[model samples]
Target chain A: MLWEKEMRVPNTAVVDGKTYATVLGMVRDDRFIPLELVYKPKPGDNVVGIVTNVRHAGYSIELNLPYDGFISSKFTRVSFQQGDLIYGRVKFVDEVGNADITDAKRLPAGKIVDVPASKVPRIIGKKSSMLNVIRDGTGCSIFVGNNGYIWIGGKGNLPLALKTINFIVANAHKHGLTDKVAEYLNEHGGDVKVPPREEEKPPEEKSGLSEPAEETPEPAKEPETAEPSEPSEGEPVSEKEEKDAGSSEEEKQNPIMHSKSAGAAEESGEVKKKGIDIEEM
Target chain B: MEKPELIKDGKRLDGRTPKDLRPVKIEAGVLKEAQGSALVEWGGNKVLAGVYGPRECIPKHGADPYKAKLKIRYTMAPFCSKGEHSRSGPNRRSIEISKVIREAFEPVVLSSQFPRSQIEVYIEVVQAEGGTRVASLTAAAVALADAGIPMSDMVSAIAVGKINGQLVVDLGKDEDNYGESDVPMAVTHRDKQIVLMQMDGLLTREELAQNIDEAIEASEKVYELQADALKKSYEKEERGKLKL
Candidate 1:
């Protein structure tokens, strides 16, 4: 009894209140036809169709809405073997179920123009400041490729946002980033740019001890040594002059006696007065 | 499984006369997350190993100031078994294999550079046809390189067996059980220094020397493949960074 065909059918069909049936014969294909070959169908579109005959080039999907659709191998990124049941969106439909299938669930708006790879560093700015500014102003998701391919997409004001990005990238090196972006938006009629202000420097008034206390000791020591030696030589000069004849006798015995008067005269102001008196004589 | 006869048309299985080795293919840094990893396939046997670290020693008590400790664990996965699942953990056979692997790598690895640290080597036997321990040792050396660990030279290991009273290189499971003797040896592919060596069963002195010579030749071929794999992984990493 368990081996009967009826028992097998029930087991296959009954699962969680959903009934499934094996295709005894080919059902009518109800898939959609893509309007443009490159364009993908929008998301949440129902794909209902019967594949009539699978071929090497593409699958001929027939829809109940009278549109005969073709799902080409070129349109799909995934490889399909024979007897594969492909699920895709129906882009278009006529009365006769003739349709064209497309794997592209959604079409992206505004593709990136090829920019030079070297220019990317300038466009992105240091730490991505340029990119951050564009994203905040435009409300768009921008992806920049290393090879200079940029992809930008979002809902409203997409064209305007794209134009702004292009302008920013073009004039990046000339005028610098923050100032140029601000000037461009003001001229072209977009959002206004807020400039940051400069910081003020602190005051540099002088304190009391500018010269420093440690340096004062050096100048005072030189004068004290010069004054003490001069007075001692002046007192010895009168005695030496009175004993001049005796001094020559002393000089023969002691060589120290001859130079004592000359030493005393040089230490006192008498040496300058004696030179003036010699010039008069 | 019935064992294949050692001698047929005066040659062993896979049509090699005595002293022929199984083909070896080695690739390093197969796993991106691991510090060092390698996948080595010696004939039908496939083995992979990952080297974790010369990192801070765990359990604190395991730290030794004398030399850098090597924590090695060799394990065979369930799929490696042909029959029922074998008991897991450090079995006597696995422990012996671990000991042999540790000793084989000791000379080649500059352990003194990493004092008070531990290097963890995890060898996984992906497919067990035969000569897994030898394959594991060879793969582990490549894994250590992939992890960027400094080594004196690459360790290359090969299993040489005596079949039909004649020495052969790289015995399969059938040839291993019926073969007369097996000597698994590891050597530094750069300087030809013997790091790890062991023989089981029986062999003459002349036969053992011949086996060692044949093993060294086979290991050099494996070393070339390991170098190529490491080069490819580094190139791939450079490409990934360029994309971002």
Candidate 2:
């Protein structure tokens, strides 16, 4: 499960055209249901954290990863206690995965259930389809965190809502999970009418299809002459020959790509993006 | 002790051919307290490896700002070996083994991903045979993967030796006791990069090269077992549709 061929993609096991199960769980629609996850924060991630300490300038929040998150007072409006639950989007994540929280707000004293962070997507469903079902049926306002700490609020069916979350976490790998979750909620919810899955259509058909098709083809068109890893099959005009002849120009560009501080920043950003594709694919 | 016949008719004492490897069984997530744990039973050797962290490193001064530190402790239990009970705790042999194991994994474990933290691996040899070092190494690789640490590739280790002028793999107790040479090695699964290699006794340059090639080939089988154990940790039917 390391790679499809000889290509080495860091952090990820499956690459190129092959799909392999990297985590322990059921595989449905080529998507793995992770039994547990080693949580890693990405920028703009909505995370639920418990404030571990109130520092001078910020609060150190435990987002359940190896790294602790920080919420600076400049970004947060309310002062938080050592144990307060904060829900916020990750403003930035450092090279070490330590996150900075912004636009922070305190969640009410509702129950917080921890699910495997990787399963959060299944709980939220595709385009919030399953989330809408839980919200309507149980009448609880649920906040699904990318870091796996789910906050359930509202005076609605608290027990039922928690049960639904657990059910979804367990059966996240099963096919047609959204429909099954709706059926399970309706059966036990009693008189609470859960909406049918038909109401929500796959969001990809509307806009996702066109946008990616346009964006992806652009990069593939100009196969970069750089990194001539794959030797062309009997092609007379290989990029390697051209690059050899234009060694002077290549040397000139090398210093520009390396010397500039902004160029270094861009290079690091590209590396981060490359390594972060471990589980998402 | 008098020298026992290490090999008979080109087969080792255990009746295995020179290229034959000892039976290895690997199981992942054996310990509840550890973030990830694995147990490897290779021939007569029983090695258990447990992994914890990417959490804050203890003795804060040692924390690396750029990557996580790997602290691997390879130890044997008091009653692990046959005959007289060995003293418990980290002896010189165990400490050296621990250092080599850490070095083998350092290149693969994507430590830069979890900077300023520590990843600890504890390898406990519950039963000892001749090739416990490689067994512990194989077990530790699976344990780290079970903990969800991002490793570039899995490592597989094995012992190659020469007994009575004949090359052998996965030396048993008798062969190790009277063998001319023993070479324990670990290699990355995909590329076969030698991460760890330690030799004892004497061998010709050609024999050493042959032993290394044999060790690499044998390690591929070990990697298969490690991968199987990691996958089985999550694929258990009982765990399918987990309750609660």
Candidate 3:
């Protein structure tokens, strides 16, 4: 017979005049289980945290959320010191100039979900096509809010959307969807394309101008195009000679150069020129 | 009490001749949280030992700048007593046994490395038939090593008792009471150093010498078992690494 073990949740405790639920339990991932907190913590709540850094008076706390929240020591309890996780509340949003957050408990739970920072771009999709489907399918009011919080969960679709979001976030970098996150969403379930947000347009325009300016002025771009064309010109004649010498060198170096400098080729060329000067000297 | 018999044909009461020892099984690092721990079984006798240590000396007043203090405590459960004796702190016999055990281990342990720190060695006798003190001391040494305490050598001990006027390697409870003499010795197995020697009842000098030789031989066998237990612990640690 299989026995099910039930854990008892602790009685409600008052913290800062608010009743908060606390349950002592184990947190399990694919690997080991760690003793941790299980509670519903909203944003802007006065919570205790440990000071991970004293210079900036910064402190971090698990907050019973998927990720830890950070706060400055100025908002900390009196005995606050470096290396101390102390108590603090959100002292209002800096953007709104509301330094008083004494009654900010109603600000809602800060989004705790995180995609690996490396994988965030994939879930956002190239134009956010994948993200829209995820938002629509799960019916989660999805918002990749600034400050690394991916706000998720709304009404009935909360659970489904959360699962899909977690799956996408966990494997975003692995599937090469960092740039085209919308494609990943469509492949998973949600078929709708999210309208590209206006915020992404500025960076796209900047890149478009920089790309033409760099390539149009460079003689190096022509050599790359000509080399491949020559291979097709005198197929058998050049094949053997090229294979024994030029082709081997080109093939061996192309992948190394492409993988290392694909995103910053112009900067790499400048570095290479300086290196040659130093070597000659 | 009946006198134990020994035949010219080389047979004993339990059907083993002279120079024979009871079966010994040793396991190290048995307790998860202890720095060093072990459980040893010799025939019917069972002993468990836990070693905590080289930690900061508590109470501040107990701190010594020159050498590490070895606190050896040997305790027996109520069930291990002869009858329904009330459980209490260390008895006179246990105090004497602890003193001898501490001496046996001192020469083998590199205590100087942990200056001013205290190494607490706790030995619990779960079941006792005979030769419990010697068994417990040997088990403690094994545990201390398993806890990663550096010791010059492993300590091995055994008891030799005279039954029916003949020298025997290890004594069982029945033979011990009826026996004419009993001798317990702890030896450092690596260097063959005699760290502990104690006896009760009378024996001629030559006879005592012979018994000592026999006890040393039996201890060497016990030392081999100790090494085997250490090897098994290392193998278990290796398996844990693979899982990680």
Which candidate ranks first by TM-score, i.e. highest?
Answer: 2
Note the DockQ of each predicted structure.
Answer: 0.01, 0.28, 0.02
A1-281: candidate 1 lDDT, tens digit per residue: 11112221210121223222210000111111100011112222334334566678777753322123577777777654433333455444322223567662222444544443333434454334555556656666665533234556676356655666666443322213444554455456556443232210101101111222232222222111121111111011111122222233222322221211111000012223223222322
Rank ordering of all candidates by lDDT, starting from the highest: 2, 1, 3
- Compared with the true structure, all predictions reach lDDT values of 0.52, 0.68, 0.51
* lDDT by residue for model 2 (B6-98), tens: 777877777788898888899987886677789999999999999988788888999899889999999999988875546877888889999
User: What is the CA-based DockQ of model 3?
Assistant: 0.02
Mind giving the per-residue lDDT tens digits that candidate 1 earns over B1-244? 5545788877777887666667777776676556567898888878889887666578667866644678889988778869443765677788899988998877655454455567889998878888999899988877876554545456778788787777788888777888888888887764577877888889988888888888889777666666555544432322111111
**RMSD list, candidates in order:** 39.9, 12.1, 23.7
Which stretches of model 3 miss by more than 4 angstroms? Answer: A1-281, B1-10, B81-84, B237-244
| Candidate 2 lDDT, A142-192, residue by residue in tens | 877778788888978988888888777644433345655677877896233
lDDT of candidate 3 at residue B146, scale 0 to 100: 61
Compute each candidate's TM-score over C-alphas.
0.46, 0.75, 0.47
B86-204 per-residue lDDT for model 3 (tens digits): 68459887788888899888876655545556788999988888889888987997787665554545688988867767888877766676678889888876457798898888888
* Candidate 1 global TM-score: 0.46
- Candidate 2 residue B191 C-alpha distance from true site, Å: 1.8
